[model samples]
Target: MKNLLIKLLHHNTRILQILLFFDLVILALHLTFGSTTPFFHLDFEQNLSTFYQSSKLIGFGMIFFLLGLSRQVKLEMKSFILPLALGLIFLGVDEWFQIHENIYRVFELFEWLRPSKVVEASMSMGYHSSLWILYYIPLFLIFAVWSGYWLRYFQSKLKTNVWVIIFSGLCFLTVLLMEILSSTGSYSGATYYWLVTVEELAEMLLASMLVFIGSKILSK
Candidate 1:
């Protein structure tokens, strides 16, 4: 167990450093501002927002890192790298600016720009239009373009890519499940706090995982 721990630490030293940096920042914020102050607030500069922003930034970095690696290896599927990087760049910007939410607001302002009557009626039937149009559609398009390239990359190097896949899955689960639950007010009191903590921690973990993946690619 001790040997395994030592090897794991040695292998993931960069990830550990990134995680430790965020941990200390969060800890310092909580200690200075009071315990509940950092957790319950939804301010733009709050801990939760910072975590979200950091995760997006890390994701942006990871895409470019992968692009560089693909170039270095002279990979055949290098054509997709620029698009993937651009998509991640947009994601990072959207994360910080809430661009999708702004799109919804813009549609709301111009009635003619809103969805059709059928779509609006469906939305009234507990169907979230934003879920379909705002998030799912864009993600589906991006994934559709990238999935085959990613599959080929993973097939060629399963062990190294597995960590990236796992962390990406975690980020997806946290955003799709935990964030949705929090938005829906599905938990209260302590449960809500715990949910928020888990969601933010997942974001942090995802960022760390991206750093680890970048390190792995660079090492190779």
Candidate 2:
């Protein structure tokens, strides 16, 4: 499978170009038709754009899994790659199923495990905050730090702009932040719609960036 990925991506110029082009098309659609229309918009869950973004993450995860399988990468690198692959794929599934939001049920089922008033009060900051963010943010920080750990490897191997990757993670985190803000009713009406649209579109764009980076690294 690693060999197949290498063979397919060794001639990657056009594929990356097409993927980047799709990124722009998605953005245009989200801002125009997607923002106005309910059927295909990104702001709503269970929509096509949402599915595409989630699937993109899962696919990128597979690319990393293949890279981990490759004997070409150093053993220490495989240790990192395997976890990243699992994280991406799991997050994709979480997006599709909303595992983070649904975790509220778990706390309900197991009351003892739920956050104490102290924790919730500390997290609240005088606003009604979603409990999911309470659980997810620490996990998110861990993932972000783990991802950032490999920048030196990719930067040296692909000679790619590390900022692009950093920016992608920023965009990804922005989606999370915006969701928290949205749930708090910090913004609503058109402001809410546009903020969600932009952040979700940024997320889709980030997914594309990772796939491109993974492909680039494999091609090298």
Candidate 3:
């Protein structure tokens, strides 16, 4: 049991590192290229844009996982700075691309946000300032951190579970196929709204590669 646990940690550490590295690169691109506009148009609030924007913070947690996997450095301000700086670059480039290409993307700065307040006031709830930040900022952070841990946990648990791994691999492939099908504009249903953009798919793959490759090198 002890040896099995050790081996699982080892394998998971490798997988997590690679995922984090790739996630960072994708995040950089996301920050650089921007998320799809459909995401931002959430009626009650949730949408693709929110997913796109929020995923970047997950990228940060990926970096933290990488640090833990490598075990070369402790988490600190200096360590955190690079990901944040890289993240800024990611957002900057994305915003620039949208503007330059006239891609019908809207850039909403933090100040311009009003959806939550509207939702609360409309619901007749008292405005809690903490709720505002909690809804947006810290929520993303908690999610990102937990997601990083979860990925590592999943990888560890499934390392030797080949059938489960294959199933998940197929599911990811299915997602790609659906995205391709939806891109044709023929599927005008609710599922179409959930379809992954080509950009998002590409970023996911790219980020996965970064995580895999970086961890492999560091682990060696």
Candidate 4:
């Protein structure tokens, strides 16, 4: 696996290029044809864009897992990367399986347990966006801690990649919070549709950037 990563880094840089190019395609297709064109699907469901994002996340999980084993990585870094690898894999599974979407259903059985604001917002969003964010608080805290460590770790060592990584983190975190916020306010069909499009696009680009950062670290 380590050898495979080395080969990928040595052989080409087109992988991320293709990712960004398709990201552009996603944008262009939306701008020209809009969501209802049937020429492409960007709905927040099982579709091309969703599958692409899931694949990138799962691929990153594998790469991070391999990095945890690489001789080049420090022992302490290995400790963090190993768990980070697992978290990424689980997130990939969540992406592919829609675990977050469904988990809210199970909890919804106990509406008494749901917060009032979450309950109110769920009624409006047509899905349990607030509850989803509510349940994710713990995980988000851990992610914050992990990101803080990553930021500190790379600040002095990988100066070149630090800003890229920071930008990626900010993009991701912003979109993360936007999940619930985007659901607020009655939007026109086009407005709501494009909002989701933008959020999902940010997710894909963040996944790509993280994968690029992981590859750079693996090479080091």
Candidate 5:
């Protein structure tokens, strides 16, 4: 039994399956109990949020491990590893604190940052006018510039790297686009639950994919 457990632990695919199983369980509980009830706030308090944070931490650890390994690989790879690790660290911090949301409130304090017609339209449609332009857009631009510098590194292992990009892109799309649509007070009942579920599921899949990609890199 111990040997079986150890073997499973060493298999990254199995590990991801276990994580997925837990996510499903949590989702089931949330749907059954509702978000406000203590029985299952998993979507917000325990499951999705926790998994998202854990994935960022795992990314940080994987990058750090790769940093050490890169020293023996090549100079260019070694140089890329540090910034990548730092970026993961920043992501972990951001996930924990929801820094972007806070930044939005800070922007809201300034009279000059009044809501635009688009923002007004979104709010009128039952969505939040959180001003993505003020916070998330700028942060995304910075991330894009940083990632652009390491495009070659990402393409180093083409297949796994592409999966990484695909999953990561999906995560951002859900967070930036799907989330906005869901927040619009327009969605209620089953539609609302399904929308939020998809958003959280995207996050979990992205994190799991990153872990799988990291494991492949480590094995190589």
Candidate 6:
């Protein structure tokens, strides 16, 4: 038991540092560009959508990389391509959903769907405002692939332990707490609740699995 514990400690120190660094970057980004200043002004709707859409997508990428890092299954182009397409589809769907009930935003393409004469006569501003995010799809895809590559590269470089697990749990819990707080109020005309409890549960399970596997492999 003594040797085992010591081994765990030694192995996890480096991995823990890496995790901490990654977390710092995540927090810093949110603070710097996530709708508003971190603690002082929390815009629920704006920040919630921002965090959920961006972080969850990034997390999806991380999961991809972690699964690849495991090396239990072979990697294939089709595997990544399908999920990437699915991710973009989900993003597009979510963007469409945002337009619902928000009078400030409009469905820009409906004008085009109508006859050109009707559009010329109508006073509607036929511009799709939310489509700007579509430009980010490629960047997000690259980030996800990079995450997987990094995991595989670092597979043999770090160590993990119970402390590391605790740290990871805290990271996941912080995200959940932030989401809860962000979802509690209204911002930019959208209100929501914990609608997908099952999905959240699955995320927690996957996160735990990542920590467990990382610890097992890195432990001396």
Q: List the candidates' TM-scores in order.
A: 0.62, 0.83, 0.29, 0.80, 0.66, 0.29
For candidate 2, write residues 1-220 as lDDT tens digits.
Answer: 6777778777666666776687677667777787568657776677777677688779879888977887898788777778877877987988888898778667665665565653567566774666777767678788677777776656787555566677777888787777767776777588888777667767776766666666666677
What is residue 30's positional error in candidate 2, in angstroms?
3.1
Q: In candidate 2, what residue range of length 10 has the lowest lDDT sum?
A: 110-119
Residues 60-167 of candidate 1 have per-residue lDDT tens digits of 465454554543534553444445555556656665666755555555556665545535675678754233344356675666557555645645544745656666
| Cα lDDT over the full model 4 | 0.71
If both were scored by TM-score, which would come out higher, candidate 1 or candidate 4? 4
List ranges where model 2 is wrong by over 4 Å.
Answer: 11-14, 109-119, 122-124
Any idea what lDDT model 6 has?
A: 0.41
lDDT of 4 by residue, 97-184 (tens): 8888766666656766555646676667576454667677788898888877876776665686566777787778767756766666
- Which pairs in model 4 have colliding backbones? none
Candidate whose lDDT is highest = 2
Best by TM-score: 2
lDDT of 5 by residue, 1-220 (tens): 3344224335766766766686677667667775577445534543455655566555545555454464354566555555555656666666666665456566566666644544666557765735553356767787677656555555665454575666676786776666666766677767877877777667666555555544444334
Task: Provide C-alpha RMSD values for all models, in order.
Answer: 7.2, 2.7, 16.6, 3.8, 5.7, 13.3
Which 10-residue span in candidate 5 carries the lowest summed lDDT? 1-10
State the lDDT of candidate 3 residue by residue for 95-171, as single tens digits.
Answer: 33432232212222344444544445634654332223323445447535743554464465446544533443454
Position 150, candidate 5: lDDT: 54
Off by over 4 Å in 3: 1-57, 64-160, 189-191, 194-220
Clashes of 3: 16
Which pairs, if any, clash in model 6? 11-159, 11-160, 12-159, 12-160, 65-148
Candidate 1 off by > 4 Å: 1-17, 20-77, 106-136, 144-148, 160-164
Ranking by lDDT: 2, 4, 5, 1, 3, 6
